[model samples]
Target: MSRRVLIKTLPLHTNYGGIVQAYALQRAIRDLGHRAVVDTGDPISLRRRVLHRAWAVRRAVRMLLPARVDWDWRASREVLAPQQSFVRRHLSRASAVERADTRRGRARLARRFDTFVVGSDQVWRAAYAEIPEQFLEVIEEFHGPRPRRVSYAASFGRDDIDEYSEAERARATELIRRFDAVSVREESGIGICADAFGVHAERHLDPTMLLTPGHYRGLVARARTDPTPAAGRTLVYRLDATDDMLRAERAIAERVGAPAMELLPTASPGSYGEYAADRARFDRPSVERWLASIASADFVVTDSYHGCVFSILFNRPFVVHANARRGAARFDSLLGVFGLEHHRAGASADGIDDRVFTPDWSHVNRVLEAERARATAYLVENL
Candidate 1:
């Protein structure tokens, strides 16, 4: 039987992983014969919107000024605009619910769906945990016939559970207990949920892994093909680009005898060195463009989790740098899944092998198939 399923996750345009994972999960649900929709709930306050407008105005002024602006403001706008437009045009299918921050808003919205999913990202983290709608706090507190509340691959963003205050921990415990079924993205998250909520949560693959590489190929095929795609080049997709990281990327590129190219974030707020500035830069890459870049790369160096994910999917040789600020648990869990823990790059770029190392795809695919089956089973049974 088909049911109306509503998924609540981070904002669609926040980053590539968030957007792709949201689309992947919704697609997976639809593949299972249910009508799925991503609920881009209205949670931003009016004050924040005003501040955003003010920032945009300031940026526009800076772009028009005589002083040479290092930032590729026009490129960033061009890249990001199409991405948002893609989501609005191709990804989202349901009319979004307005006023989701209040009880009245959630109550009104709940009546429209038979089930609610909170997942495929850091929805369980402290930052979004308090949001009644995102964490299913509203569904847990619903007075009328409550919709089926399930969490799929939800990450706490860290291994430690002590980050929450005593009251907040209590509330989280209460809310999580009300979930019909809870699945976490990382293995560590299972323990955190168990320790904090005294509830056992299953470990599931990230939504990106839920789909096969062939499914992603379709998206890449649709992307506007690059007229002059780079060959035998190292594609560096770093979320936290430090001076040392940039140096390491250059060294690797030199060792491999390939040019170094970077996929610039839509809103990276840092200065690049002369070496980095000299290399090619892809600013504000759309999801399709991002996928195509990774698919065509000879090798990849990245600190982003999804970066690691697509590299694996494409069966590309890649190195994952430790992103301490974003927490290492995500990488640890994912790398451990594919038995690629040795792929983690050290602090220094030296001793990093120059040649592309082939992964054991037969084994990797087996593991992926098993995890995919388990995750899909959970969703099928729950929803």
Candidate 2:
């Protein structure tokens, strides 16, 4: 019997890692003979919301920019205000509406399935949340008593329970205990949940790593582009901004005599077209094209989680930059799983002198196969 599975998360909205992981998981779930759909836990159409958000972001950025051209109080305050109580509350309410919208959206998507798999990103981040009650209520309504509640690759990221007050920790623990099966995307997360939430959960790889590069080779092949290797320079790049990390990438490229290519964010005509702009970079006679372009890259330097995950999958040497963002500490734990601690990036590129490439695909592949089997079984048995 085909299982109806509703997968939930705050869709990548703009991040490449988020999109790839969500799509990979959706594909993997579908391969299990189940119907799986990604619901960003919000009903708001991101495409429609982009213009308003872009304008808001522009306003915030402009207000925050210093008059003297320095990153001073006025500029910092504008950027910092979003973290204030009033702004947080307003954002939370906006999110609640979005979640309610997601619930309404799910009603149409939920009709075809039986199980709901929730996760693969920082869906529990407080900044992105309205209220716990509002969040939990939506979860229960759609994935209530009947369908098995499986947290495929959920993460709390850097927000440790210990950091919260005793009451908040207890409350979170109670909420976490409700899940039927919980799996985190990093080993450190397992410890966090076990010690903090008082629940033992398995740690799994990002969905992108679950399938081999060959599985996605066809997609890359279709988007093949003329090789753009810079004589001796290799491609060094990142998703978001990181001066030190980008510097490190340049250092590596120079040391190896390779030019670096950085992939930047592209505007989506619609949410579904997030990868549409990138489509040109990977086009081929028969392949999806974008995949091919990424595969052809000599090396990758990125701070994005999905970047590291895909780099490993494609056998590309790369560096993973740590995010200084408040809730993104999970990167450390994720890299630890692959024994790639050396690849971690911080504020300064201090230690890594001239190491060119270090990746253990053999061990990574074995672990991936084992976890994929377990994840696949969990879906099949529950469905």
Candidate 3:
């Protein structure tokens, strides 16, 4: 009953949603009385790898200079320090030996973890993949005496496979079939799995939805200086804030009679010199602080998948700006989960739709309670 579990997900870093979702799944597994550790230190993109190496050399020379120059490496270390610290504090991580990418490495991995889970994010999207095999390497690379493989709420980012080539689709089908269980985060994903892989996949909640809002509030309370319980404030969280989105946020704030706070990406790149040294491109809120902003908000308007997730978890009345580029199908699937798809709409100038702010909390909670039970049952049966 007490099996060791290894969680395979998008590399934990600045992406708040990615980090929180990974945290949620691992936490969920451990709460079930199983040992779970998330695998970290994943390979970076080729461009980033090259940039990091260049920065390392520059940093070495700058350290010896009369006037020290702040490079990306040092600044990045500062920005990600809190996030790294959070992972260490809140989650168990695989040691380097257990995370090795070699045959011997996987052997060590197989010996430690009885089951491997790839999930709770866009793990199957090739464009989003850092490692060559993407998240599929858990099964594709480990050849001998493989661990039980499961995909919990794994997403291809979109229902359409326009970005996935014919070859990638073929390989994905092969790797997908190897999983003992498969659950997708979107209803549209269920059909994609059936049609593409010829395997039945269940639609499940995003891992963050598995936990209660109180659990997240507890995290917010841990922050030393992070503000929490923001009363009478409308939170604007957008991946790409267009003019329309901004106007919508302003209108929503005006209508609600609450001040608006824009929560932009703290991890935006391009910081150098004294200005970069003195200030980050944006204030890098600790992981808990980021959650606190959402947890405490009176209302939220976001284009992010995870933004929508937290709003629902906190039972905040909110509308999503359909981010079709990142994956609008996910929004469709997520809102459809609570039968609240009308909650997503374009933020046009004429007016922000009335449905954006009026939500039936009682009905949403009823659906969430039932869905959480179904999702937990799937996890219990699998891990």
Per-candidate RMSD, Å = 4.8, 10.1, 3.6
Q: Write the per-residue lDDT of candidate 1 for residues 275-345, one digit (tens) a residue.
A: 13532343466677777778778888899989999888878888889786876788999999989887788
Q: Could you say which candidate leads in lDDT?
A: 3
Off by more than 4 A, model 3? 41-68, 95-100, 130-132, 138-144, 225-229, 265-281, 349-351
lDDT of 3 by residue, 1-383 (tens): 89999888877877889988989999999999999988755633557656878988987887576434546665666667778888879888764332455666656767777888888788877778642355445445555677788889988888866678788888788887878899998887888889877999998999999999988877877666455545678888878868887887787788888998777643554644543545645457688877888877888878999999988888888878988778888898888878777778676625555665778888999999999999999999987
Candidate 1 stretches with Cα past 4 Å from truth are 42-79, 93-104, 128-132, 227-230, 265-282, 351-356
- For residues 9-57, could you state the per-residue lDDT of candidate 2 as single tens digits? 6644334456567677877877777666666645456676676689888
TM-scores of the models, in the order given: 0.84, 0.69, 0.88
- Poorest 10 consecutive residues of model 3 by lDDT? 130-139
Best-performing candidate as measured by TM-score: 3
Output the better candidate (2/3) by lDDT: 3
Q: Which ranking of candidates, highest lDDT first?
A: 3, 1, 2
